[model samples]
Target chain A: MKARFIVSPVLCIGCRTCELACAFAHAIDGKLGKSRIYPIDGGFKELWVPVTCLQCEEAACVKSCLVNALQRNPETGAVELNQEKCVKCMACVAACPFGCSLLDEQHELVVKCDLCGGDPACARFCPTKALEYKPIKGSPKKIAV
Target chain B: MIRITINGKVTQASEGETLLKVIRREGIDIPALCHHEAVEPYGACRLCMVEITKEEWNGWSKYVTSCLYPVEPGLIVKTHSTKVIEMRKTIVDLYLARHPNCAEIQQLADEYGVTKTSYQTVVDGDNCILCGICTRICDEMGFHAISMVGRGHGKVVAPPLDEAPANCTGCLACAQNCPTHFIEFEDKGNSRTIWGKKFEMITCEKCGKTTITKEFADYLAEHRELPREYFNICDECHRRSTALDMGRIASWSKEVK
Candidate 1:
């Protein structure tokens, strides 16, 4: 199972388009075609984070989950949380050292990167080649489109 | 389950966990400041220090912030060795001196038994303690109204004094969120302008006793457009700016001797 997300800060221009794209991809409307969106407190920021799940071998969210809702996906080697089973305990919120997982606005479940189901929308929307989805081994060969 | 040795104890960790999460789960209790599970690892606090014993790197151990460091296969971690503890103590002490009165700082100091501060306190009677929390909050949490200026002993946290942004949005998030309560918003006599309150300045390196204003130093650097390297020199030291000409004066002193 592979687990890691690499980001090059030097390549990042701090544009925050990745954040906009992530919010759009996760938005209820499922489109990036608007300028004004309600400023959901504690959502994602506009900084170009190019963030992806580390898919930690020792996942904090998995260990911290009291309800055992969060688990590591065997197929993709990613930590996957069962939202139906999630009780919103926020233990995973406190357990994650990177502070990656966040409670959605509904406050019913924690939200995290699922690699956009193998085709990331954030990587797709990045303009300056700052965000790249790559394999976990060898050199991080840039994703072309 | 990935089996690994942490501080020589054989432990099992999940596949993608960071080194910090691994040791923390084992109840090793490594010290970490500026680390919140809800926020990304800023790595600014440098308190969650650990020595990694990596065989791939020829049994060489390097100091790293465990919070940001990822766990690797065959990696040996020493979370609490004598050297690591000492380093943590020194770092905690430095942080304490920078922010002497912060609650989180005091807590960490108490945990480390850091009763004394290592750096000299600024004379504005500030308990500053230097957690970098204010700057971090402004830059990382809020969108960047304030930032850290200077480096090491001369470092300070403040907003751009010479100019205020038209796009300020008047959030006041930086002051509202400061852990130290060092930042304050006040109404000037005529207008209500939120300022970063007051902070003490260090004594001039040359004058030996007189204290200059922190804003004055900032003014000299920013308004006068002086290079950052010369920012620490006081106006008096700068006024006597004739060391090159003084060499010609010194040549005549030998005749009187």
Candidate 2:
């Protein structure tokens, strides 16, 4: 199966280059439409953590989509949004476990990562390669407490 | 290409080039402390302050560090306005307060017309501007030995715990690049002290004079693929030996004739 988006906190230099790349790719006329990925400061002063959609197997956002706009692509296994079917409701925003979904104030639309249709721009422009996209074997289904 | 007016002189500047670079290219002097071409431009020293006036609806302009400020089209930049000069005077005065005895700081202050400062001087401490040049050089050279620690009044550039750094090679890169000459290097017999850490000095096999630390030589030999024989002699002795070998070879050729 295709590997998921992995973030390395150690490699990040808090440069916010990923935020700029994401905003540039998704923004309109220099107005950032709420970048899908957010670089949140970690416990230390210089530590940065790029928080984004993890594309969970048993996705909460997919299940919570009341309009059935969010659907998982069977081939790529990426949860994508059907803008036509979306009613601007923010159910998936609240339901997301990773806090990846957000409301774009400028466009008044809910936004989240669709993995850029299998080639994520944030991972591509990461200067330090803190974010990676690749393949993975069988992994643990549940988080270890 | 973009058109920018510096001191009312029209000049063409490439898009995204720093205002400091463009200003310097135009023979305009803007004093910057934390800017080095080798490393990234860190806007710490605030010495390269310039008033930038872009095409606007009103007569409003903003003060920005020319080092980090990018040149844009229809931008009006004034590097040494009365206000900018005054601001630089205050900045140099502040630096003078921290580094009271530093000749470079005194020179900068003098050049900016700052003779005295209202801020209290650090009497006993060494003059370190904390521009991060030394630390950045150390990191760039793959030493990662020294780093700036603490903040505000307690801020100091040293190894972790302010003790002898385990990874330090006594390379003197930090000392060599230090603008304020804050780093102290001293050699005593078979040991060298820097930042309160004494490292064992390696004696040159031929000259018998102290060279770099044995650990640093080994590290260079292992990590940098440098031959061990190169470290066996001091720089002076090595040069002399090379010259002697070349001379002997030349004389041998003459004798063969």
Candidate 3:
């Protein structure tokens, strides 16, 4: 099924569990994970919203890539960063509107979420249902991972 | 354009293009460990060895490392002939003897059906295959922080004087581009350790995320002429500020109406 990772600001407790989940899932060599999602203050008292890639339809990050490294995975509908072609010039870092594309300190490449290639760890480990990998309503239905 | 026959197929290539580049463009698989498009060919791995011949040489052929060999008119190349395969097998077998622990080397050996080494395995050896890619990439990145030290079996990639490289910006280009994944470094919290040197990494002011090392930032500021404040914020925070500025521009234009 075609899916997207969505976050509910109101339901987020700002526990940073999603951050931990993403970081843990992507960790290499026991290094601390470079989280693709993080909790940001949401203007009101005690209101923290976990922010992440919205996976925009016409992503600026994809456009700004010098080597055409960042691309859309058709099945997942997530922008995938091809590490081989990426030069780490940070053009995508400047192009992303919502700031989802960020630099990976260890790999020295700009990276963004890819819905974890199918099963998103952030949605799986989210304490609240704030983060979810929801199927598009009109897309293909109930194909198992 | 120059015409070169590769693997029984004639292809037109630009003058002086490396045979590996032209051969790769034709979808031929020639394993080159020390070869990186970002750096000049060092021919350290010799894995891309291919046999070449010409009609005027009376069928005599010479095996040359394709990464270093340039394409020439009327040159006939065999990328994976029996002799080329044998040479690659021998090279990979030597690599296996030296770097048995490295998964990359082991897998490469497996591809050539060289499960056991004919030479004595260096049990105490580490996975520096002496490919020189790391040192070359460092030089390409303008760091020159590491280089090939010593020679023969005792040769290794090390910083000068065996001390922490004072010029190392901790850019991780050397470690990240390592084909065998041999170069070692640690990035935990706001500090990074590599080449026996420790560097304090910069943290983003807005997002509190650790970014590049301070030395790398200062180097960019001095060499690339980037403002020192450019590295103060992480990419995400920088994008956020750009979005805010764009919003301000939109609102200001609206109010001016």
The best candidate by TM-score is: 3
Give the alpha carbon lDDT tens digit for every residue of B114-216 in model 2.
8898799878757888899878866765678899999998888989888888888776657755767777889789998887788887676667877567766
After superposition, the stretches of candidate 2 with alpha carbons farther than 4 Å from their true spots are: A1-145, B1-3, B10-16, B56-58, B120-126, B247-257
- Residues B1-257, candidate 1, lDDT per residue (tens digit)? 87778878888878777888888788888766555443356677687888887677886789988878877777788888888889989987877776666677778889888888878854444554455655554443334666676787667775676356332323344454444556666533322345433334435466643323344334334533444444344333432332223333433443455
Model 1 misplacement above 4 A = A1-145, B1-3, B8-17, B25-28, B37-40, B55-59, B101-103, B118-142, B162-165, B170-181, B185-257
User: Model 1's lDDT to the true fold?
Assistant: 0.56
Best by DockQ: 3
Please tell me which model should have the higher TM-score, number 1 or number 2.
2
Against the true structure, what is model 3's DockQ?
A: 0.08
Quick one: best lDDT, which candidate? 3
Which ten residues in a row are the worst by lDDT in model 2 chain B?
Answer: B242-251
Question: In candidate 3, which residue pairs clash?
Answer: none
In model 2, the Cα lDDT at residue B247 comes to: 42
TM-score of 3: 0.68
Q: What is the TM-score of chain B alone in each candidate?
A: 0.55, 0.84, 0.96
* Candidate 2 colliding pairs: none
Q: Order the candidates by lDDT, highest first.
A: 3, 2, 1
Write model 3 residue lDDT over B61-140, tens digit each, in one string. 99999989998999999988999999999999988888889899888888999989999988999988788877876776
| lDDT per residue (tens digit) for residues A1-145 in model 1 | 3433444332455566767777676665454332111111111122223334466677755755534567776656667776544544343443454445665644334677665566556667667665666566765344322
